[model samples]
Target chain A: MINWSAFVVVVVVALVAAGVLVTLFSTALRVGDGDAPWRRPVSVGLYVVCGLVVAFGLYLIIPALHAG
Target chain B: MLVVALVIALALFFDFTNGFHDTANAMATPIATGALKPRVAVAIAAVLNLVGAFLSTEVAQTISGGLIREGPGGVQVTPVLILAGLIGAIVWNLVTWLLGLPSSSSHALFGGLIGAVIVGAGIGAIDGGVLVSKILIPAVLAPFTAGLISFIATKIAYSITKKRERDNFKRGQVFTSALVSLAHGTNDAQKTMGVITLALIAGGLQKAGTGPELWVIVVCAVAIAVGTYTGGWRIIKTIGRGITDIEPAQGFAAEVATTATILASTHLGFALSTTQVASGSVIGTGVGRKGASVRWKTAGRIALGWLITIPASAAVGALAAFLAGLGLWGIILDVVLAAAAILVIFLRSRRNRVDHRDFHLPQPGAFVRPKKRKKAVAGG
Candidate 1:
């Protein structure tokens, strides 16, 4: 039997992640150029979050991380 | 032992072609957007591919164990059979590369293997259920899904900021493209590892269901990495500039969508083609942005290439298997013929070379003589 559930889950997760990441990164770029006092901190936070996502993605690829 | 060695060599060569052939998948947009220099982009992709290869063995295991059947009732795939299939794949890959088409290397491999198996060991060797569920299903779905995600993402990105400074988006592209390269390494390099391990198992040097050995992984990684460093500039030109005019923001969106889709598919044990995913995302981003016109003609050509890749490569695989089945002399003849064909393709490519140095120039269309005439006028 095909694991259709896994396939659906992958599709959903990837779509959500791609949407969220693009929005977040683009917003961060917008905020960085704003004149508001809080813009700098908010942009920094978003960049940090993006960095963490990339780091986590890299970590997941390491075989030992998933191995029991 | 000699035949096993030959199979391993061919597998590595396939890996090398896979590396250069698919470099466009991760780095094309970045190069197009000037987010990274051509050479620097390929260098980064090469290193990430090497590092990424060490990250997972799941895909390798899938290739070595799950795709083909073993035992008395199943089709027996010997090392010679594997070699013949690889020759088919390599020939197809080189032909497509010479034509500047970004077809799927994954499909070429699958088609070649399946075709050789049918000719050499009969259709019973294939797991039809796995083929449909795992390989075929994902192949059809992944690109559309990736395209949709990228399309939505690009719209959202443009909506967020109508005209922002591109520097930040270019910076973001560097990261997203790196992620795509890493995901590519995790997926594509493992295919070669799987093929080599399959050959080893067929030769009785390894257990039937085990993952590739450490040495096999290392050699495959190095081969692919070296190939990545070489850069498939022709395909890069096609993906980066031929299909659509891409800005930095669009590049970032496309790369992120591609990375997400490839990683997700890899996690699910689906061997999707990175080339198709990347191409789909590029086209999707093109459609997402208002007033951005995708070169529908070029997209159609790429789609046509994808449609033909499987059956065309399969035909060649079957033919190679038929010829090699004759005897030892036949195997030698196949090798000689394949080598001559490859050399002829290489020499022909020199007549109109596209390299990293001039990849950004307006490329000649498949049937356009005007560009060549213009070039001649300018030279004179």
Candidate 2:
């Protein structure tokens, strides 16, 4: 009766996604803290990657946007 | 027709309670961390919920998938039974709200329906396999799963970011929290839409096995949005301040974890509670951060509330179904009693009134543990 497989997938996905997002954002914050010329661009790039992940999340939510 | 209309109204009302009850899930941490002001946070959540309601209805389809038998060879569920169930859910929602406990509105609704079905129909009417696979298991795992994710995320968040860089996380929180609100709208509003659709079908107004009508979706969205805007500040204070002193980093971690977990569950059609996942995330952050004190007493109360929500609402649903079985006057009596209870709860809420101003912004770099005040320190 239990859909253990789906439950497992949810756990694994949540852990990985949350960990990656937090780590990326935090690393960007740390790198961007001091005003080094390269640091700003690097952190900005990381921020863009984070934005892409959020965009992917949006894509997942909008059923009309995706093909079944 | 009247019974169907009444049930739809009650379903929307339950959706509204769901909105305010769970505004705390997404907006609480952001509001607590001053990433977004309390008013601004709720406003954003409300709008996103409205938009999110239109995004998907996948979860809605699974809401009553096979829980109650209502076709040939099965007992037909009456609109009055649904009404009784709604009353059961709403009463529990309000009572939990009054106590500032973040319980599962989904569980309450399911429990109410299960109770009403059991009373109105025989135990044979309920599919125990579906109940266990969909609702019961998800209820048990949601918190722990979200909590584990949040715990790890929190640890990683604190490790890399310096105290001065905390504002980066604060800024990030606004976006993450917004995602949670959007996910909430897609998830929670769908539940109401599903209930209304089911009622319409049961009443023979809509074809069986069809999706919610556009009108149903729109109204449910608006009701939930308005309720989100109104804000359940009492529950917010309890989750935001009551759980643990949330910093920007921890808030960010919790919000991200919650958003991911909710979206994943929604995608998988797992009938998980957003409240449970959010609460678990916050508590997870508490445990993750070194020196952060978790109010075990408050956490225990929340855990207790989760454990009892289904049974408590079921008991009420059973009684309500019994009463509703008596005919029109009994239904009227249930309605009158529900209205009275709602009014009383609202008045009692005012006595210890909690609102946006109750959450004060903490000074940067100064870690302040929220004082466990016996009386809520409030202004007007």
Q: Which candidate is the best by DockQ?
A: 2
| Per-residue lDDT of model 1, residues B1-380, tens digit only | 77788889889999999999999999999888877888999999999999888886664444424566855666667878888888889889999999889998988887787778789988778888877776677767777888898999899899987473444587899999998888888777888988888788888899987888999999999999998998898899999998898888899999999988877876775546788889999999999988888999998888888888877877778888888899888788878887898899889889999888874443232122354356447645
User: Which ten-residue region of model 2 chain A has the weakest summed lDDT?
Assistant: A28-37
Question: Per-residue lDDT of A1-68 in model 1, one digit per residue for the tens?
Answer: 56777778777878888988988898887887656889989998998998888787777666667687
Over the full model, what C-alpha lDDT does candidate 2 score relative to the true structure?
0.87
Top-TM-score candidate index: 2
TM-scores of chain B, in order: 0.90, 0.92
lDDT (10s digit) by residue, model 2, range A1-68:
88788888888887888988998899998888665689978998999999999899888878868957
* Candidate 2 off by > 4 Å: B58-63, B269-271, B361-380
TM-score of chain B of 1: 0.90
Clashes of each: 0, 0
User: Pairs clashing in candidate 1?
Assistant: none
